[model samples]
Target: MLAMGEVHTGLLQNSGEISESTCRQVLGLMAGETVRVSRRPIPHALSPERLTGVDCALPSASRSRIRGVGTVVSRCAVTGGRVAQGSSYVRVVRSEADRRLPWSHYLSRPGVVEVLGKAKAADLAEGFVGDPAPGCLDMGAISGRFLDLVQASPLLDRRAPFRIPRTSLRWVAETGEPSIRFTLHTEQERTLRLTHPGPFTPAVVDLCEDLATHDWLLTSLLIIVERARIGATPGAQAVARLAPAIDHLLHLWMPAARVEEWLRPFWESLERQPGFTRQWRSLVDRVRDQIATSTLALLSAATEAGRR
Candidate 1:
């Protein structure tokens, strides 16, 4: 649906956030469930104001916010990874496991709503010996190696140095458990909880990331909207909103006409992007290639899990 260069070009045109209308269209395509929408502000937890460029760990979904449901819980390991030191835990008290959370949940702590968060962006980009400059535009489809970072097992940028900040799959293999643990916990100290089974494996991890990243691609999109509030003109402004094409993947079930219709106004606000035309071809191909490879690896791993 993304057709070749469109998705990444959109990413180049718009930084990372994808508009909600586009998200609904994309999600409708991929799932059987009805897609819901809500709008809210970013949480203080993941706020740069709180961390002050410290590059803190990804924000955790707050169980406190969601109302009257079965409990929501999440556990994370702060092992010797690139960010954070102490362990992390989240629980939506009395919330249902499948319960829909408040929209704010997606803003500050991306884990609750979207798969790939700012932490993933800043940290995941590590270890590239020859990546363009830090300021250069980074546009491309989601890659497979990146999908590995989504898994509960440990993740490392393929280019990580062999020293302390390791990136290979070794930690998971060594632990015989997914190094990045996630679970439902009851107490601050985790007196009660639910946990995902061993290995958390390459397949499940990426699947979760894909789910979350899709959401991230949608909601945090308000970030671009927020940028527009300041009166920045299109092309004159850095990319901030969803491109019409990206909705294809997330809003798979939506009618194409409605998607384009929704995107029409948003399009009027576009700021022209520089260089997106020049570097787009090879970058898009590279991203698609990565996706193709990751798709196979995840499917094979999931298939084995099912067979077991």
Candidate 2:
């Protein structure tokens, strides 16, 4: 794809490498009549730059594809040399060649997020490319949505909805024990099946629990941090430090980019502050470890839930 920043930077330029059919598919998804793409040389392998990651802007008619926004993450032994397995980066991949490349191919691998559908893809693009969360706003939005969904669910009663329709309420209803959100949209009947097993159901449940719990931890922690910056109890300061760290530990399965961007800054902030007492740091570390343990347990839960 065309690199927005580099296109103007007078970088190595190439001609069309994408087939017409692929371009049509991409344009259809984009809902754009006219679209432009750039081609680049792709060795069988990659040459990682000194940076493990870089922000790339790809121009597109719509915001749907990369257009002056998007960041690519990769694993590099050197600056930009070899890409390790499971080292997929984010981009508006459209062509077969685009998807065939290792950086694009690995994104679909298990343990990585497969943001199905345009809506979810937009969210992913926004999170990666657009200004995300903007500090606590993202945290607040997550909390608000989670609580709304939880409140919407049947509280472990009323058969707890054995099955939920694929509507806006799909994600909320999915919290029920032993639930599987169907891969195929109910309307479209495709004769496809995943060659590999989906993530363990137990892990999904655990992740759900962790996410549910995180609403409280991060939202509350942010509140405490704001109040304490003006000076509060050593105890209060200690509590703030622990919240984001635990959030990190619990969110282990998430894309590292998201985790690093969201939680790491907060952890660093707490570390730099004078409020944490020795005992407080110890307590926070303990909770962080607990979150780590819980993350692994989550996978088991998701797996077990699938079995039942």
Candidate 3:
């Protein structure tokens, strides 16, 4: 069995974190489906799960023809009422019959895709992580549509504090000795390969979402600091450019906040190698110092003027 998914993370297009009632209205993707909410560690809400029918070729590294037919499960989530994520995944399994079944047959098993022909798990995993070929299952597009639905809601003012591009994380997991490999492909793209000891579960999906959220936070902050041009630009001007980070992006560095205890080790392993929090703290401090210096300069100028 294999689980593959993509998560798109970005800031909510609002002035500040929204209220629970507002979240309910914005995240209500389907009728008769309750939007789950948890208010403790952080205010979070999830839209009801929705499925999209998919009958496409499964990506394979060996160029072997592999076709899959099934539905892809997707949902929208808001964390701290500030961050929005659209996550979609499908479980791949061998079909009992080597032919295309009726759509209803596939719909009966939501989020599960049955491969009609021979396909190795390794090949599928590699193809997904590597460059995607044409006509392959486009989970990103499905996920993007769900995000678009939430962002296009009239309830939102569409005034995001800053214009940070959405980041995407593609992940594939299979049953084996526990192991995880996360790779940052580009500025806006990341990929992960994992081997878990037991059966695949939604807890794994939660773990992926958590990782994507924190990675996006780190990436957004780094972009803000770079654009500030601290040494080259005037102190006040640099501070002005960094204001968004202070106002909207900082204080969102919580990692593993929603992850289960069993998945803590994965987050820990990522911390040791990439040092996500370490880098985030350094950037936060730099932003604060710049703001402080800018304030002092303005004060000193005011005092001199008074003396004159």
User: What would the TM-scores of all predictions be?
Assistant: 0.19, 0.20, 0.96
Query: How many angstroms is residue 120 displaced in model 3 relative to the true structure, after the best TM-score fit?
Result: 0.2
lDDT tens digits by residue: candidate 1, 186-251: 211101111223422223322232222222233223333343332244321222222322232222
Worst 10 residues of 3 by lDDT: 245-254
Name the TM-score of candidate 1. Answer: 0.19
Top candidate, metric lDDT: 3
Clashes of each: 29, 22, 0
Locate the minimum summed-lDDT window of 10 residues in model 2. 3-12
Q: Which candidate gets the maximum TM-score versus the true structure? A: 3
Native-structure RMSD, model 2 = 23.2
In the range 194-260, model 3's lDDT, one tens digit per residue, is 8887899999999999999999998988899999899998998899899988877786677888888
lDDT score of residue 74 within candidate 3: 98
lDDT of 3: 0.90
Full-model lDDT, candidate 2: 0.27
